[model samples]
Target: MSMNLIEKDRVATINPLKTCQPLGAMWAVTGISRAVPLVHGSQGCSAFVRYCLSRHFREPSEIAVTSLHEDAAVFGGRKNLVEGIQNVAIRLKPDFIGVITTCSSEIIGDDVIGFIKTAKGELKEKIGEEAVEKIKIIPISTPSFVETHLKGYDNTIKALADYVAEPSQPNEKINIIPGMVNPGDIREIKHMLRLMDIESIVLADISDPFDAPLRPSTTEYKPYYPKGGTTVDEIVDSANSVGTISLTKYAGSGALSLEKKYNVPAELGPIPIGVRNTDQFLRNLKKLTGQDIPDSILDERGLLIDSMADVASRYLFDKTVAIYGDPEITSGIARFVGELGMEPKLVLTGSKSQEFVKDIEKVAKETGAEIDTMIDQDLRSMEVYLKDNPVDLMIGGSDARLMAKENDIPLVRVGYPVYDRVGYHRRPIVGYNGGIQLMDLITNTVLEKYYEPEHWKLQQ
Candidate 1:
């Protein structure tokens, strides 16, 4: 909310908390089986998204684009979008098609929704009524100038739920709206739900898709999309769930939309980063499912506590941390850090969201810790702040890694675009078990710093 804070630097490139919007769209659509995402803009946008996804998921991500050229840009790309959708439908024969507009299309004021309608009409005519009934097309407008990738992802998920969730008789199932999390985290959430004996539906679940097993004896790996993502039928039947659990506040928007349309109730909570947040998520699950917390979860929580206790005297108390990422992620990390008896000195998010300040304030109030919260913050401002007053550690995306290295502060990679490291797609950072993993990572990162060469004496 501090406008002056962002204006401090006009031309400094720092670690960004956010990424491009088209990438977010790609990530979102990856959750759908046989769902081809058609980028309604330049070929570069589609190519860049595919590259990033391939790096993160370690699989070939096939996304179609209108491949806008000079003529399309000047005359408007409506024709390109229409033709692109038709071609993707014919070749891929996907159950659903997601059309996301890029900056180029938005700038030209191309009516994506209208084009989708027209495309649908054309498909109906070509495929006949019966075949048309099998296919669904969803359009989403993602203007990068208006919001970051987080918002774009949120919007895409909301649009999916709106278009796919059907009116059905209620069933004994829970809808799990996991925000933009890695495949590992999604799997962990499903595991926790299974342990609780709660049947749940996770929209766009990509645990298997992004982290499939490697085929031996050959360097060629099969594409992941065909195997991963929630099925279109499952999404349409999500309305049958008893209630919804949203892992992050941003994902709650999609849950809210589902609730409004189908009268399904939703439980909104932060992403389970640290022990306390994970505990909160589990407790909510217990309440919603009318089931008791399993002893296994309790044991996991105990192990996390024991791990922290082993290093509690070392640095748990009076530890200062700086965090930057998506707004919801910043809030979740802030809550988790605060609960660990650490001071979250600086919290920054590139994306602007409603209740961001309120969410941070609530976490600070709950943990009795004061935090400096910033929204719409760029990496330049974050770097400036770090230069002026640094902390013991930083938690964010890959961008923060560089700042941490430069300042000699250890970095905990927590959010999206974790480009430098592998297995980020499968790292679990949610639920009880994930809490244990996170505690170990943080404790080890701190201990690694403690036992550095400078702190040790030369051996005889």
Candidate 2:
């Protein structure tokens, strides 16, 4: 830790973890079956977004752009928006089109809603009025200045619910609205629900789309769309569900709306990153469904407990760790660190709210962790904190590699933008099995600290 590290301005952001809301919108759209994530802005904005998503998920981004230029920025992007919609409809014929705004569109005061209406008319003129039934365009304003990417995801999902969902006969189903976890985490949640024999609709399910397998050469190729995600009918039927289980508060806004409108009970829980949180999630499911906790799951929990007592508890106990990421994941990691009998010296996130901070503080207190937090903060603040307070381990995204190397400490990579590693999308980080896997990472990373390169040379 460098003692010369200076305090940064509170409002200034250096190497921010949270990007604009448009990315969030794009992520949400990716979960809708055959839905195209369209950006009503400059071509460059969409390019950056596509690159970012592709790099992180290791899959095609498949986002569409209106190609708004100088003229479109000044006089509004209605013409470009219409053309973009038409092109997508003709080229891809997506079941749904989710549109998000850029800073340029927001600055020029482009009415995305009006443009959508125009798009409706244009599609009618080009391919007959019945074409509206073939492709639905759902637009939500997501100017980058107002909120972080999480909001964009939440708002777009909420807007999508409003746009397509219709009340129907009660289906006695459960809706699992998970937060910004990877596709693997989402799949684990679904698997658990199936084991419990609970019918569930994972709103905006990205499990298959983001981590899609390489198709065979003879397989048919779908243009600008992936063969995964919750279908349109599933969205409508979610209204008829008996209850809703939101995995994280960050991603619960859309689920909350569904609960209110449909008179369904909503249980907001943690992201299930560790033992305690995963237990809470299963308990919530049990309460809602009145199903016996499967013996297999219980046995899996016992395995987690056995491993913690034998292996992780020995090597990682009393270890000091620094964690930083999104709001929900960081808080979950903090609690998990405590579960391993480790002290989390600093737990921070880029996206913060009073509600979120309070939640983190509560989790920290319950876990008996004395943690310093940076809410709505950046990497620089975290660096300053790390400089002043050294820790044995750092757990976060690839960005934390610099601080870990500088401090001569090991880093356990997790959360978003894990660009330096592979199979991140498929790694389990939820449920009891996921808890075991997470422990595996922690104990392995901690044990690696004792590995001396000098000893390796003597093996010959």
Kindly list the per-residue Cα lDDT of model 1 for residues 1-460, writing each as its tens digit. 1211233345443555677777777787878877888898899989988887787677777788999988887899988988888888776678888888888998898988888888878877776767667877888778876777877787887887788889678778888878888888888998878788888788777676667665554434334245667888888888778788888786577789888988887888778777777878877787777878888878878887787676655556768888888776678778777767777888888776647877877777777766777776787777778888778888877766666888899998876778788776677877767766766777678767755654334222
For this target, which candidate reaches the highest lDDT against the unseen true structure?
Answer: 2
User: What lDDT would each prediction earn against the true structure?
Assistant: 0.77, 0.81
Candidate 2, residues 299-382, lDDT tens digits: the string is 888998898887655678779988888888888888888888888777777776666667667766776766677777788887
Candidate 2 weakest ten by summed lDDT? 1-10
Residue ranges of candidate 1 with Cα displaced over 4 Å = 1-15, 216-224, 453-460
lDDT of 1: 0.77
